[model samples]
Target chain A: MLELEIAHNWPGFQLQLHLTIGAELIVLFGRSGAGKSLTLRAVAGLFHPASGRIILNGRVLLDTRSGINVPPQARRVGYVPQGYALFPHLTVFENVAYGLRSSSKEVHHRVMEWLDRVGLADLAGRRPHQLSGGQQQRVALARALAIQPDVLLLDEPLSALDAPTRSELQALIRTLQRQLNIPVLFVTHQLAEAVLLADRIAVLEGGRLLQVGLPKDVLHRPARPEVAHLVGVRNLLRGQVRGISPEGLRVWIGEREIRAHWDPAAPPPPAGADLLVCIRAERIALVRPDRLPPPERENLMEGEIIRESDYGLSQVLLFRVYGPRLTPERDYDLEIEIPPYVYERLGLDRIRRWTIAIRPESVHGIPCG
Target chain B: MDWFPLLLSAQVATLATAINLLLGIAVGWLLARRSFPIRDLVGALVTIPLVLPPTVLGYYLLVALGRTSPIGQALEALGVPLVFTWRGAVVAAAVSSLPLMIQSCRAAFEGVDPELEQVARTLGRSEWEVFWTITLPLAWRGILAGMILSFARALGDFGATLMVAGNIPGRTQTLAIAVYDAVQANDPTRAGILVALLSIFGILTLVAAQQLGRRLAA
Candidate 1:
């Protein structure tokens, strides 16, 4: 297990993170300059955090209050920085054996073992410049693992590879992490990569960790509108809580009323309090206007299809309330997504209007912050 | 033509190059990897030899190491006299050639990616190990070229060496000083031979430096 809570101030970006990781793969997902790489560097002891404690496997790597900061060499964390940082002068075998200098007798054996594990044993004699990008990545991983660290930190290792090679290495990294059972902290801005490899994902923005949870929870139930936007949810509507009950809250978006669920453990906002409602584009089901309206009191919106876009496997439809005044602050437009098959079967291209069914359970209420 | 100056020049240049090699690398690494309030001032001080007239530098050294000075008195008490001797030639040559050595070495050290050192540390290697195994190897090409340049520069140094060591036959007279003395004595043959040798050596070192620099860049 690895736990870190650090706050560092930079010129343009401040890094404020509080996180914990188990033996599973956890991805730090964020945009450029979001402090993902900085966080990884801090944990690896390359960058110092102003205040916080980092504990790895019950060892205190850093504690600012006690003025204890372990050097990078003593931290025992394997860090594969971006670009692999392979020694250009060293061969693959020597690179992997670099950290094994203490165990001189078994250095070669251990290095070969790791190279074989990464399926690069034959290329160990080649220098880093002679290998392809993916091959170099494998060599870097082999070198990092040779130290037998308690945790592995990878920084955008796949960002430099081609699409096919990236996916291949992504799967390889995931399999290696599980087989080794070492806590791994992977950093990337690509959400798809995070979703594919991470058992849990931590979302960051502007140097702050916005949310951290299982892939499904963070994707479907973001804690804020910004988190929802980053995770690709497009139908975020500003609303006010008109009524509250033990079951859910009734929110008013313009002239429409939508029911949203709030975690019961946390006290729900009082009635008439401002809030934000997040409905995923895919979750807003499209129902024919002539069909029977969803049971009474359910969340529904009747809107005209203003635009449509084809995205190969799926299609997106932009729907706006039929008779509402469109203003910069209160435009009641919701983006809905449907499969290409549904779009073709329903002849959505020819349809001018859509009745989107916003399921009560799908409408997530986020605090208006 | 007396051949003794040739041997003395070779010895002085060799010793000076060795001394410059150590001091150059130390100072170069310090400049490349550290930042302090006086860093710019220290850098300028190291580079003063590149721009200062050789005789002016020798004048300062002469004043500082004169018989009445504390350092010269201590050395004289220890039976090691520097003024008007071959050892003074070594000091003069080394000081005049130090800037070239340091510039090349500093550039080489700066060319090494810092990330490599960081990764080495994460791999459990101490700073010293990282320097020996990674930094020194990667920067060797530039350092080798720098050492050769310093050697060539020391071999041809005339003004500073003449000021401190004086033109003494079979002892302090380096190749450059010998050429001057031979010309003054109206012996064109001796001056031509000495000048030709220095020229050939200078060309060879320049070629080697260019080749090594190209390889380092590649």
Candidate 2:
């Protein structure tokens, strides 16, 4: 387990955070300059914050009030910085052997063991520049893990690889992470990678953490407007609350009432509170002309596809609703996404007018100023 | 065919290079890795010798280590006086050659990626270990080149050695001073021999440094 609370005042960004990680992979997801890498460095003891307390497995690594700050050498945390930062002069075998403090015999054994673990045993004699980027990344991973550190911190490790190699390493990382019971913190800006690797996703923006929850929850129900945008929430509409109950919130959006999910743990918003309604592009489904309406309470609206972009496997369509339009000034109200096969099967190219259903559970709302 | 001056020059240049090898690397690494309030001032001070006239630098050294000075008196009491002595020539040569040595070492150390050293530290190596294992190995070629530059500079130094060590043929007179002595005495053969040797040696060191620098770049 790794727990850290850090507060730092920098020129443009102020870092304030309190987080705990158990024996699981937690992905720190954010946009560029959102402090994801900085947070990982802080945990690795490479970056120092003005005030913070970092505790790993009951051992205090940093406590500002008590003035206890451990040097990185003794912290025993594995850190693979962005680009791997592998020593250019060292061979792959030597790089992995670097962190091991055992006798020569034991070091050689452990080094070769980790090399095999990362599937690089045969490339041990090769230098970093001689190998591919993915191969170098594996060497970096083996080097960090060979130390048997209590925690592992990876910063954008796979961001520089080809798609095939990236997915290959992603599976390798997930499998390897499961074998080690230490807290692992991974940082990435790509949401798909985060969803694939993380057991929990922590959304961060502008030096602050917006929310932390399971991948599905963070993707479907972001807690803030910035997070909604970062996680690619397709439609964010200005709305006013009409009513609230155990059922959900009935919010008015541009001359129409749309139902949105409301958490029961918090007090319900007043009937007239302003809100930002978040609906995902993938959650809005097209209704075939021959089929009946979607299940109960799922919003039904008539909209015509205005513009479309073909993304090979998935197709995105701009949807503009009929009478009492959501946005009268614009040509589109909501953006919807469906696979290409579905588009052809539904004959969406031939039929521009369509009915779309938005399940109330998929539409989330955040209180607005 | 007097060999004393030749031998003395070799000893003085060799000893000066040794001192510079140690002092240059330390200062170079510090200058490259650290940022302090007086950083620019310190950098300028070290490079001043490269631009200053040798005679002017010799004048400062003479006063700083003259018999009337505290350091000179302290050394005198310790039975190793420097004024008009061979040791004074070593000091003069070292002062003049130091800047080249420092610049070479500074550039070499600065060329090394700091992230390599940081990663070494995170790998459980102490700062001292990292310097030996990572920094020194990576920077040795440049440092060796600097040492050679300093040795050549020290070997050819004439104005500063004359200003401080003075011309005493059997004692402090070095190769450069002896050449001057030969010319003053109208001994063309002696001056020609000494000049040929010094010029050849200076050319060889420069060539060797060029080759080493090329290899370092590659």
Candidate 3:
């Protein structure tokens, strides 16, 4: 287990992080320069936090208050920095064996085992410069793992590889993480990569951790608009609470009233309370214009496709409502996604006018306060 | 040609080159790894013997070891003489060539990546082991080149040797002095032979230095 509560002052930013990660793949997901990498560095003992404590496996790695700090080498944390940072002068085998100089013959056997595990045993004699970028990355991973660290930290390990190589390496990393059962803190900006590799994801912005939970929960129920945006939620509408019902709460967005599956744990939004309703682009269903309105239900709008972009597997469509923009007090834009097959079935490219239906459970509401 | 003086000159030049190569490596390593007040000033001082007229260095050595100075008196009390001796000539050559070795070794050491050293330390190698196994091997080429350059410089030292260790045939005379003596005696034939031998030695050292540099770059 790794528990950290750190507060540090950067040049123009302040970082305050509180997190507990068990022996699982916990991805620190955020946009560029959002302090995810800095957090990893701090945990690895490469960067000293100004205050607070870090404990790994019940051992105090850092405690600014108690004046205890472990140097990076002694912390026994394996850090695979971005771009691998492999020693260009050393051959792959030598690189992997570097951290094993003090060990006996058994350690040499372990090094070879790791090299074979990474599928680079045959390339051990080749220098780093002779290997492809992906191969170099594996060599770096093997070298880090040869030390058998307590925690493994990877900073955008896949960002340097090509797409196909990245996918393969990602699968390899997932397998390794499971086999080792070590607390791995993987940092990356790619949301899809985080969803695929992480058992739980922590979303960060502006040096703050906005939310940490299972990947599905963080994606389906972001705590803030910024978190929603960072996780690729596309439709955020400003609205006001109209009324509360036994089933759920009703919010008024523009001229349309919408129902949201109310989260009981959240503070009740007083009537007329301003709020933001978020919905994923893929959740907004497009219906034929001739379909009659469902009885007594809310959350329906007629809009025209103003722009569209093809993304191979899916097409993103931006819509402008026929009526005036959601009031000057509550401006909002709607977006929808349709898979390529769905687009062909709906003939969405030929029709500009359509009705978009947002299901209540699919729409999440957060009080603007 | 006086065969005795010629042989003595060759022996002194060879010994001086060998001594300078070892001293250069030691001093270069120190300069590369340690920092002290006036380090840059000391670095400049090392190279002063290279640029200053050889006669000036020779004159300074003469005063410092002329039996009147404390160092010279102490040596004399031990029944060892530096003045007008073959050892004095070797000392002068080593001093003249010291800068060349330091410069080469410094450049070589500077080329090694600091990250490699850090990695070694983290991998359980002590600082000394890292220097020997990783740092030295990587910079060996540059060190070799520097040693050779210093050797070549020491082989050609003339003015300093002449001033401190006078022109004692078969004892203090080096190749350069032998050639100069031959010229003063108006024997162009002997002078020509000694000058040719000096030229050959200079050319061989230059070629060796260039080849080693190219091999390292490759």
Candidate 4:
């Protein structure tokens, strides 16, 4: 386990983060300038905070109160900085062997073993520039792990790779983490990457962690409205609870009473409690008149296509309900995203009036307080 | 024509360049990586030798290390006095050309990405190890350029060398002083030869420095 409690102050920004990571991967997810990189640097001992205590396994890496600040060289942590600052002058084999301390034969064996593990054994003789971006990233990972560090910290390591290579490396990382069984903190701003790789997601914005939970929970059930927006929950409507039953809870969104899914495992909120209904745009499905209407429990509403746009792979359609508005002040109620193929198959361009349905499971409710 | 002065100038420039490499790298790295109360002041002092007249620089060196000065007296007791000797010529040349070496070294060290050093440190290498393994290799081209420039400048140094080493016939007379001596004795043939040699050597070093600088930027 790795524990971090850091408070750093800058001229215009301040970062105060406290998190404990176990043997699983805990992704530090945030936007730019959200202090994700700084947090990783602090863990790596590259950035010193004003006050903090860092412990990995059973060792105290930093304790400001006791003034026991171990330097990065002795911290026993693997750090792969963004852009993989590999030794440009050294070959791949030498880069991996840099931190190993043993006899010459042992060093060579260890370096080659790591290179083989990363699938870069063939390129060991080549310099960093001779290899592609993905290959360099692998070399960097190998070099960091070669030290047998107690914890691993990666800062946007795969952001520069292509899609196929990224997914390949993601699998490689997962395998490595499981094999090592060490605390791994992966930093990224991409939600898809975070959801795919993280055992738990930690959301941060403006140098503050808004929420931390499982990917599914943070996605479908964000703790705060800001986190909902960050996780791509485009339709957040203000609502108040009207009633509760064994089936589900009823909430008033605008002038309409909509039934949203509340976690049955937890104590349900009382009636008249304010809530912010989180509805993912992709979850809102466009109902085709040619097919049978969806059951009433899955919210069925009549809305018109207020606007539509094409973004090559996907299309965004701004929808406005006809009867009562979900957001009365805005011109549009919900923004829906569908693939171009679906848009064409549905003949949505020619048709403006459409019925939309949202699953109860998709309509998540968070108490607004 | 005798070649004693030519051989002496080459020996002095080579020795001075070797000495400048160490001092230059130390001061240059310090200036590039460290900040202190008198950082700018120290930087200005390092550069002052370049902007000052060589004769004025030589006068200061003479006062600071001559037989009358404390350092010179200490060296005398140690039996290595520098007054009016070939070794004094080396000192004069080294001092005169140190600025070029330091400027090159400072720029080289600055050009190196600090991220590389930070990464190396995390990999269990000490600060000293990181400097030798990472920083030195990356900044070598710049330092080499500086050394070549320093050699050229030291080889051709006249005003400072003449002041401190005093242009003795066979001991302290370097190529530049030889050229002056030949001209004073109305021997244009010898003066022309030495002058041509110095000019060609200077041009070659400048060209080499320019090439290295371009490659460093690339």
**Given candidate 4, what's the lDDT at residue A161?**
95
Per-residue alpha-carbon lDDT of model 2 for B20-127, expressed as tens digits? Answer: 998899889889989989988989999999899999999998898999999999999999988789999999999899999999999999988887887787788898
Residue A178 displacement (Å), model 2:
1.2
Chain B alone, TM-score of each model? 0.98, 0.99, 0.93, 0.98
- Model 1, runs deviating above 4 Å: A102-105, A245-247, A289-293, A296-298, A310-314, A324-332, A339-341
Candidate 4 Cα outliers beyond 4 Å, as residue runs = A243-245, A264-274, A288-296, A367-369
Query: Looking at model 3, how many pairs of residues clash?
Result: 0
Model 3 C-alpha lDDT versus the unseen true structure:
0.83
Q: List the candidates ranked by DockQ, beginning with the highest.
A: 1, 4, 2, 3
How far in Å is the alpha carbon of B19 misplaced in model 1?
A: 0.4
In TM-score terms, candidate 3 sits at: 0.81
Clashing pairs in 1: none
- Per-model lDDT: 0.89, 0.91, 0.83, 0.92
Model 4 C-alpha lDDT per residue in residues A1-369, reported as the tens digit of each score: 999898988898989988999999999998989999999989889899989899988799988999988999999889999999999999999999999999999999999999999999999999999999899999999999999999999999999999999999999999999999999999999999999999999999887889999999898889999899889998888999988876588889989877788788889898899999999888989988676465666888888999988999999999999988889898999999999999999899899999898878888888987
TM-score of the A chain in candidate 4: the value is: 0.94
Q: List each candidate's DockQ score.
A: 0.87, 0.66, 0.28, 0.80
Candidate 3 local lDDT, A1-369, one digit each (tens): 999999988789988999999989999999888899889888877678899899999999999988999876677788787777676667888888877755568767887899999998888799988999889889888988888889888989999789999999999999999999999999999999999999999998888999999998788888888888888888788889998886688888877677886887766779999988888899888887677458346467777787889999999988776675654342236778889998899888798888778777788887888
Q: Write the per-residue lDDT of candidate 2 for residues A1-369, one digit (tens) a residue.
A: 899899999888899988999999999999989899999888777888999999999999999999999998999998999989898888999999988887999999999999999999999999999999999999999999999989988999999999999999999888888999888899999999998899999988888899999998889888889889989997989999999866688889999988889988888899899998999999998987677465556888987999999999899999999877777768899999999999999888998999899889999998988
